[model samples]
Target: MDEKRLCLAHDDSLRMLRLARRCDDLVLAPAPARVLRDADGSIDPAALVAALPNELFAPTAQNPVDLRFDDDASRSGCSLVRSCPGLLRLPDDAYLEVLTAEGDPLCVCGSTVAHVLVEAGPLAMTSAAVTLGRAVGAGRLSRDAALVRLTGFAMELCGRYARDPLAPLVGDVVHDIEPVSSVRELRAFLDEPTGLHGVELARMAASYANDGSGSTMETCWYGVFCLPPRLGGAHLTRPLQNVALDWPAEAAGLVSHERMRPDFHWPRYETACEHQGGDHTSEQALEEDSRRARDYELCHIHYLPLTKKDARDVNAVTALLAQLLSIIAPYETDAFARRARRMLNDEGVCAARRVLLAQLLPPRLRWCDGDA
Candidate 1:
């Protein structure tokens, strides 16, 4: 990392420390440098510490002599080292930053001259994956959900925001985090016996995790299609993401010269679905889309185009899904509906389903009456 970036990150860290000081019980944990930098860049300091307890650490001296402050209290960094009885032993370099009641910095812990660096700055997908892996290992979050969140966050940074330089780095990091063949092994490693949240982690790992999603909308769409019927989704088979289509040699001129990777594909039904964004409005993009559709038609594949409006409009998306499900398996729609009804009896899961549905469906068209 450059000195300028490091100084900015340090300033952000100090800002976080000031906010954390306002809550008497909260203590800043030793986080990866990327986490600190991203936290500094993306979220407010107060919001970052919102969930932490006010008095997480209490002042304690490792040696009694060090606790005595002569004329300069600033010299005694030990004044801020609180020894909480149940807290785990922190790293040797870990030191608390003490601040006044009004959020002014008092002094840094004298035990260490500076904060420890865990990873490089200039956040990348690998940094996110590492942070997520640690969070799962520590039982702070569910593995599947954390992966989805990480992928979505990285996509926003690298794609929608035009951070083009980070694109290749993000792809490489994602590959390292979730190789095509070792997804199960990766999940196992993330959920290894931490003895704290092992059961929850294992459960989440067992649940369907669509690591293949390429964007935030795709991730959300995947959840809508693959989540169990009990969770207000169709519980359909997982779709392959970014699959390439082989076009006939004569039709090569029609397809986009760039690439022909479909957003989501169902191999068994020879069907594919694409979620079109605002970029599709251009004449050139529309021409490309029509060519792709023609190619799929020629190959006897069903092509479905889902617009951003459709994604946000629950009635439209679900209606289209129901039609597709009927085409896929006419007899199974009733079974899926029944499962959704059973899910409604459990208030907790039903509430979660409602929250997810609200994101994909408009308020008036949101799922109700145990409808799938």
Candidate 2:
């Protein structure tokens, strides 16, 4: 719509708000605001005057504030202001009294005054109503359009989250596991050890040399499928388990899994001591175990350290925060935002991050063993 038209509608809305506010305050005053009833026993002034302060009254009064009720146009059962011009100019209290009396005013002067007030009431609040009304009206945009834009925004945010400094580094890489599930799958993968010819051969490569002999099938799977869609659109379920862990979990080390076992399964050939039983499993063993193989759900899509530029920077952190903010913002809705504002300037961001981490944590991590 053109600016002029939009402004007009907004103005109408503002007026409505002001009228509502006035009606509400006037009704609750110590003295009860009463209205007159016509001969047919209808409340001539309508119940709107009482309903106003309670906020129970509709935004659109029974009759247009600018125009009095029309018999055919309104349910309020009154004639339009043009037809009752004498009643429009009455002072607020005097007109309300005549309305309560439900009869023609005893004097012509009273009628003229009542007519004027009715017109003035609506006009007084028109501008403010328009601005607020326009905002409420504009917010009803198509949800489908919103979803599409949000989805794109989500993807951009995920990239930032993937690059956060708090994320794990490569050399600290202590764990690695195969993508296979059952023994049958393990045997199949081991048997078909593609091109390389050693015990610890590379199953995937990220870059190819001048000869172009090497391929990045593994890296491709890791990047495209391993990372979760923090936004929307992509639909790869259980992406974490699908991740193919390289010898060292680097940025491209992990691939997305359709589903993963709760525990990172170790091969039977790997020594039992190495599997779960080790001499180091002594004092504070439980704490070590808790951190060893995180429950699958606790895993987040992250780049492993490999490049020399794997250092922290402010801009990078800010970008990551932006993306994390988007993902968690929906949950930190109006109610949550209110509480957060009282707590910190970045309350929404902090709340979102906390909520996201809580969601990522496995059920086991929610509590620690203690005396009950």
lDDT of 1 by residue, 1-372 (tens): 111111111222223333342334333343432222221112122222222223322222432111111123222233322211111222222223333445333322332122222211111233345556788779986554464454343333322121122232222121111221123433443344433222343324234554455554565576667666544466678777776777667666654444567778887878888878549988999898888888787666689887765654445556666656655663356775555445434565544444445433323333353432
137-199 per-residue lDDT for model 2 (tens digits) = 599423222222222212211111111112211111112221102222222332442331221
The candidate that wins on TM-score is: 1
lDDT of each: 0.43, 0.24
lDDT of 1 at 121: 15
Record all residue pairs in model 1 with backbone atoms less than 3 Å apart, i.e. clashing: 24-54, 25-54, 25-55, 25-56, 26-54, 58-82, 59-82, 60-82
Q: Against the true structure, whose lDDT is highest?
A: 1
- Minimum summed lDDT over a 10-residue window in model 1 is located at 1-10
Query: What's the count of clashing pairs in each model shown?
Result: 8, 39
Candidate 1: where is the Cα deviation over 4 Å? Answer: 1-182, 198-206, 248-258, 330-353, 358-372
